[model samples]
Target: MSERVADSTIKGFLYQFNKTILEIVNADDEDVITVEGVVEDVDVLSASGELEAIQCKYHETKEKFIPSLIFKPLLQMAEAYDRNPSARIKYTIFIYVPNEDHCQKDIDPSILNSALATTDQSLSKIVSRISGKFDKVEFLKNTRIVFGPSLDEIECSTKAALELLGIQGSDVDTLLYPNSIEKIAKLSSIKDETERQITKAKLYTYLSSATHTAISKWTLALRNRSEILKNIKQQLSSYFSQNSRDRYFYIDKNEIDDYEEKVVVFFGNYIKKYYSKPSHVTAPTFIINDNIEAIRDLEFRLYTKGIKANTGLVGNSFVVDHFFRDPMKKINRNHIEEREFDLRLLAMDSEQEAINHRKGDDLYLVCSNTPNNIELTDVNFYQVGISSFNELEYVIGIRNSHE
Candidate 1:
């Protein structure tokens, strides 16, 4: 990884450790609140006002047990201790030494002790080389060396930390959920220790409510509303300034931070509203693969509950009673003639049943069975007529003729 990416990853791990493991374990201590962007990678303030500063070091390969490798952190610790003698601070050097293969293994404490005792270029030699500012005692009394955790440990701890923060059940799934990615990206900003804690607390509050709502809204759009999904994809493509010809766009976590606020707005003002519970009507029942019995039961329930039935079928409905229910209609006046004609044919079996089923409402049926042409006809009670059917053969013929 690049230095910037590596540092960012380390910083993320430290933040997780502070929030998830440290905070939860010290919940009652109150005094042991963590401070970030301060003297150390992880700083904890105790009840007596003393500070525990932990510095984390990461290496792609096992860190060499030598004075040059360990002297810088020791020097930083000496500086911090000198400035905070009254605060009685202790410094910890946490080293994450991964192998060349990128797998972490524990380091032997003796290796660190031996490095300090090296004769020619030892810790003492390094300290002497640094203008005699700090001695071996300062390094020994004020600082302790420790090893960092494995990659697996981080993942397990992350899961535990999220749970400790009350992100349980479905919210747990939201951790990897796509819509929640933008919210996570919004937290990428660097801030002082206090503001960081407060911001995360506020985020937790939002996740508790927004995660479920976002998930539900996404599910509704994917399952029932193709047009909504298409619009969302279009919006994303436009936002990213990608090829308009692209039919679908994948969301990346890195890019999410940039447009997260816009996503929040889209979800709040548009997507949620589109999928919100219908006040005047209930949810539409979609009969998958033309399940007759399911449609019959749904129609019966709608009749018994006196709920306006909003139903869509993918295939043919052989039963005439299915037609009697309210038909999906184009409400504009321009469609009124076509709408009336459809109502007439649907109610042809029994005008009284159709009238009774419609219950004095103008309802039209939306079907995929396109006849060659629709014939306008007048009939008793409701207009009923049948016309010849053709495939794209007639449409192609017309297009060719015009050409």
Candidate 2:
């Protein structure tokens, strides 16, 4: 027969076999339902009083086979069984092959056919292979089936076995139990940790870039103090005292100093908010090198013009502020000094060491002790300037030098 014809014949025989089994088992009034268009060659439902669900299968092909159609129904039955413990509905699967020789040559017919035989030698073998092997419940050992027959004889043989067993079907379990909340909780915890790490990484990148930009802008503004003072004055006018009798004016230096202090405070707050804890040190190792070198070059330029720039170690590293100061120029000197008074960078071997120092001081920069002088507070310190020793040959001037 053609493959299609063989499949159709096998399906018809399976349906007849299913009907016989249902009749022998005395299935429920609505339990002998037929499901069409299923991929399986034959599917049987027996919801009789004693039996929960039974599936029948017949293979016409010579190829070795195991029926996969029963897997879903078996799972459904197991779930139903779990819900109604008192429901004494048993599951059975029957597979009928042509004969012993036919079964040996093709599929391991013993796997599904064990239930029908008088002696359970074949069933015991299949059970041994399954017991303690899978995490889920094992297939029912109560299954049985008769060996093969031609299309005409298969249904009769199946009916004979069903009558001999005195099978009776009842209501099969229908409810599918939900998964436990503990499993979902574990998965959710894993997802939460992943998201937290992602957020921290993103925040770190944002804060690092913002700090770099702020430093760049501050350096540029310090270079052109007069223009920055003009801008600050213009911006601050709206906030100034507007009384006609009391005319309030801001000094250029004071305005510039206030702007610089604001920038410092902004950097401090940004670091506190996003980078409160020292994360993995992925930033460049030699960040201070270029800035230190630039300071040295500026000192050299001043030295070439016969100007002596006094440089001293404030906290640990040599100060570069002296080289940038112009004696004839004066803007916001008091405010600038006040903002720098407490701000000092301590040289450290690694970022971890720097973090450790900051942690000891509650993540704040500390200043070197100056004898007989009040310590500066409410300021910020940033590490800047070139980092090379070769650039140190250009030492020139110093700012706020009372000594």
Candidate 3:
């Protein structure tokens, strides 16, 4: 594709991503958001169990609403309808035509029918596309065509929705916006449809814990930096104090070029402090985002430092298991299978491992940079504050106060 075409295509996906986030942010606690679901783009399963199927369309060069623009999308909806005619699914066509006066917020079925009768995509063709089945009146009744906000507007709506949910202030844009997008993108990108979905409870758990992100230093900025790291040091005291059960560190992939070194130092400091205390705490489960390779690389470094990890790579080969297990036995000083985690640093290959490994505290400290937020119901929860990793080092006793 041409550069401009590719850019437009990407922009279209961005619109869909932003729109999906808005639906999730505005949804009720029980609602679920599914990407690339029943319809082409996005779907929201409401608290009442009703499904709202959405198809988002954007044309930067277009001047007005074209009824034909929604025809194919409606056909996709029609096809879905044919699959289960009685399914309680609400079809939505979210479109944007540059001139507001020339577009519509709600589609007029009569106009839509008249357009279909004239356009090359006649009603009969739609039926054939859906294997000789289609709905006219019923489809229009269940279908909704509304004007979608621009990408920027949708992002603003996302921020606004977050504020309504109790997280507000300048950080909403600086930290929360792109961070939330990164999250939704991750969920939406998952290969499994079942895994490519999130509910309000899950999103809320992630949002509530993002306060630390508003202050931390990293390079994965979304918008222009006006005051991103502005006055960052002032907020360091509140970041992660050594005593808090929850500590979070935000490290966007590629955010730091020399992150392995930085992350090692950070993890090393926190690990020692966490285990050194009188509590039988053995180790801290390092929560990484979507990068397992980074986790493996990190394990090698930790092992070299006499600190080994239980990265899931074990069982792949004896060499793999031994490389990690030997050092862990020497450094962690406890059997990997020991259930006593209060004072035992544990090894984890995945988030599930940490969950299964926890013995005492139903709530344990999980530290990471933009951790893949798990549903609290699935076995996780968190809270934290920190301006910079250096500040975190000091608060967690990794760095001396005298320094």
Tell me the TM-score of each prediction against the true structure: 0.40, 0.23, 0.53
lDDT of 1 by residue, 1-403 (tens): 9987865565444433433333323344344434343777556665677767777665535454444465566655655655555557777776655542323333344544455455644346443444334344544666676655654454455455556665555444333232232233223234655643323444456656542222222222122233322333333333223211111111121223223333223222221222222221211112122234543453454445333333322264444455434444444543222221111122122122222332321111112221222221221111101011111111112112111
TM-score of 2: 0.23
Model 1 CA lDDT for position 261 = 31
* Candidate 3: 10-residue stretch with minimal lDDT: 338-347
Q: Write the per-residue lDDT of candidate 2 for residues 1-403, one digit (tens) a residue.
A: 9979855663644443343333324434444322220212123234443443445455555454344433333443334444553544544434444443323122233423333221446434433444333323233432233334444454344334333432233111100000111111122234233331112123223323332111111222222323322332333233222211111111111123233333234223322322222221111111111244443443355455433233224454554443122223222533221111111222222111332211111111111111122122432222112111111111101111111
Could you tell me which residue pairs clash in candidate 1? 327-364
Q: Pick out the ten consecutive residues of candidate 1 with the lowest summed lDDT.
A: 380-389
* lDDT tens per residue, model 3, 133-241: 5566777788888887666666677778776766545367656665676576667667789887887778777876664333222112234333333322234443334
lDDT of 2 at 70: 35
RMSD of each: 21.7, 28.8, 9.5
For all candidates, the clash counts are: 1, 29, 15
Candidate 3, residue 360: Cα displacement in angstroms equals 26
Q: lDDT: which is higher, 1 or 2?
A: 1
What lDDT is obtained when candidate 3 is compared to the true structure? 0.57
